[model samples]
Target: MPVPPATRTSPGAKAPTRPPVRRRERQIGGSQRRMADLQPGLDFTNVALRPYANVERMRNELLRCYLLSPPASEIPEAISPFTVQYISCVLATYPRCMLSDGGLPPLVHRAQVQGQEMPRALANCFSLVRMWYQAVPGSEAMVAGMVEQEMERLAGKPPGQGDYILLCTFQAYLLYSIMIYFSPLPNTSALKYKTMITLSELACRTVRNGFSCAAEHSHTRPPWETWIVAASKRRTFVTMELFRIAFNAGRLLPSSVTSELGDIFASGNRALWEASDRDSWGREHDRYLLDWEDGMLNTSELYRPEATAQKERVERWVQSVDEFGMMLFAVCAHIRGR
Candidate 1:
């Protein structure tokens, strides 16, 4: 082999070295730093779950820096792409389908006209949360004190509740958490700590029960039901990531908790997710390559260095991920790039 060209140096100097991929520690969870035993359905109580200081820092940072900051002028590019992408996910999910990211298309109509009390109640509460943001700014803890109490009550509900109810409860806490951090309401100081605890509880509950109904294929379950599972899983994982990055708060969470996010399956196939009925979802899902037919992507595969080994296939999977899934992708990529 030919000798490699040597750099011409007049004086003694160190050779340049490639920079590191990360500095302090690999904060974002993907291919690194996960506990092996902390798989899904395990007893979360056994895990060493501890609250980190970063949650409050993030809550304040987002509220003061992002939400309460003055309106932007000049270029429209003032907004971060990540912020825009996340907003798209929120708008897609809320009011229309409160539980799943991007909202489930089939139930969007039915839930409006003939939905159950829990879902319907969610619809109304969702509107109030949205309206609170739109309405004139005021004090009083963002929402009524009773709202927090109700959410507390809902969260403590028995374990045997239906998937739908569990998901709805998860949504209420999530919505209230948003108001607690971002909404320009008074008394946030009072509810902030309580909200943080509730959030962790909700995260654990969501992980344990939210996607429990999911299946690997449509053969045994209807496309609609699986779609819900897929959306729920994706949303929950991304929310955890958002919590991590939004304040460096996630830095305090144990690797076991963070690692679980990657092990779960994320929904692929946007067409199927958006399919209005069983027939359309079946057809679209069937058209996918055998490997991706179920559209069940192991999320860990998403953050690996060789994640794009299958570029075209990966592209299809990335496109299929819902709004919150996209956020998860962005957060992981953002941290890894650093």
Candidate 2:
């Protein structure tokens, strides 16, 4: 999915609202100390959820960070590739969502699903409040505030309702945003104008804390791996899988940073297998193999022996799937209507 033209400080779009408060700077390592003393639990009782709401706001903040960040090819060696790869996942999904029409493909719709299931999966993946508190002790209050704000945004109130899936999506957005901000080198100054130093620090804190929590709880695997396991164990598992997909895709992103991007939708529901059909995603993923086998790949698009052949391939894929199919109908009725 191509990014909408109006993302950046659109003319007359509202300026970023001020955060609730700013406090005296913590000692450089205070947060780590606090995190060490925190506890881990399942309940988010009495926790405010406002900042977690306004899905659009969170999405846009991520977009600004990703699409407008420095080019990956030009990133100084001081930056870690893991961080860059993480952000790329965020940027990749927007186009994917639009193309797949928010994951309402024919095969996915055929799988009987209950509406609440998706949100439940999201909630499970993001309900790491306990881990977050303990992992980044000094930043607990601030993290809590951010969570509250997001929950309120989701609930359509000053303080929104919090859920697992929503938070997972938001986190996914964060990772993808960071990756894309540096993926390409399109006019550097125009894209790099936004200041991510603060957001980056916060992101680093959140991820590092998450890592620490995972380490304490499950010593067998890396934090990201542990997160994947936890999310999978939850009632809602799609969110974790989505993150997994993004992570895998990032590994395939070359240092060239010139891959063409477009939309490719998959299941938004947890019960459904994203690429159950061998025809679409599986085959498409496989094509990359052929591209590697032969140096004929022109950037990321398939080389057309003739442009007409390329056009036909697209048309066949599009025609095979219902543009106004049953799956899409549900999305419009349930997701869009919401």
Candidate 3:
């Protein structure tokens, strides 16, 4: 097939193929070459960089295993390793979040004036919980001391005080109570359980006094602050109720001590619970209300259609709920024999 000397292909002609080994080499080095060749196009402005990026990664890992999973069949004899790691990350990354002054961290204070107290207190309890779990010297005594201090603080304040502070106090009390109840130490179960029950009663009363049930006619989305406060109150109430049922089982407490679950199903919308920002929250809240008006089911009643052919719908809803919601749902199902 020898003809005139083979003409050279122009640079603009169809691209030539590389040898197999050369192609493999290019594939292996492609990413590195691209990275080396990349140039900045535009600089970002007003971007809020996370101060604890490494800690955030740890938190994400812990959440993926614990909060993202279904509740276990039984509470572990000790806290899970993931929880311990998460607590360590939180303590290391955001030490100011656990300050005992009940003041908000500077960054948090700048963002909002209220609702920061509960989170701070909860963070403190988490730190204490880690210490207790690790059996650190004097950690048990420290937790007990904090419990006493909180009790005294509550006793000194009248119920007529601001609902914001009351809510925060109740939340802290709830966390501390649970911590005490679940301590690994022996010879403390009776006292801890009694304390837990008492705190549960107090928390329920605080909810009733501080937050009103969402009115059936109130179809409009409220401001973020107001909506979040209501949502926290409702969630706290439901959590305490679930704990009480699970702990007491066949035993019945006095009416004054027991929480009435009237209209509890009218809690915050799942979309509102899951929203990350004010605008998104508002959109989700509105969408949820619209769905509600159109006869959407509540989370508590979601499992009622087991005999129906809506298996896919049930699975989707189950996956939609967050960890806390899933835990509550699990408790309800346990109580109802579902």
Q: Which candidate is the best by lDDT?
A: 1
> What would the per-residue lDDT of candidate 2 be over residues 94-203, giving only the tens digit for each residue?
32332321232121221112122434323322343323324453664564455434433433322122332333433433322332333322222211213232332232
lDDT of 3: 0.44
Candidates' C-alpha lDDT: 0.47, 0.30, 0.44
Which candidate order results from sorting by TM-score in descending order? 1, 3, 2
**Candidate 1 vs candidate 2, lDDT winner:** 1
lDDT of 1 at 244: 32
lDDT per residue as tens, model 3, 176-289: 544454343432333344455456445544554434423323555555655555556656666454444333331222111121343334343455564545666668877667
Model 2 clashing-pair count: 45
Best by TM-score: 1
Clashes of each: 0, 45, 0
Per-residue error for 54 in candidate 2, Å, reads 30
| Evaluation by TM-score, superior candidate among 2 and 3 | 3
If scored against the real structure, what TM-score would every candidate get? Answer: 0.57, 0.23, 0.53
**Poorest 10 consecutive residues by lDDT, candidate 2:** 257-266
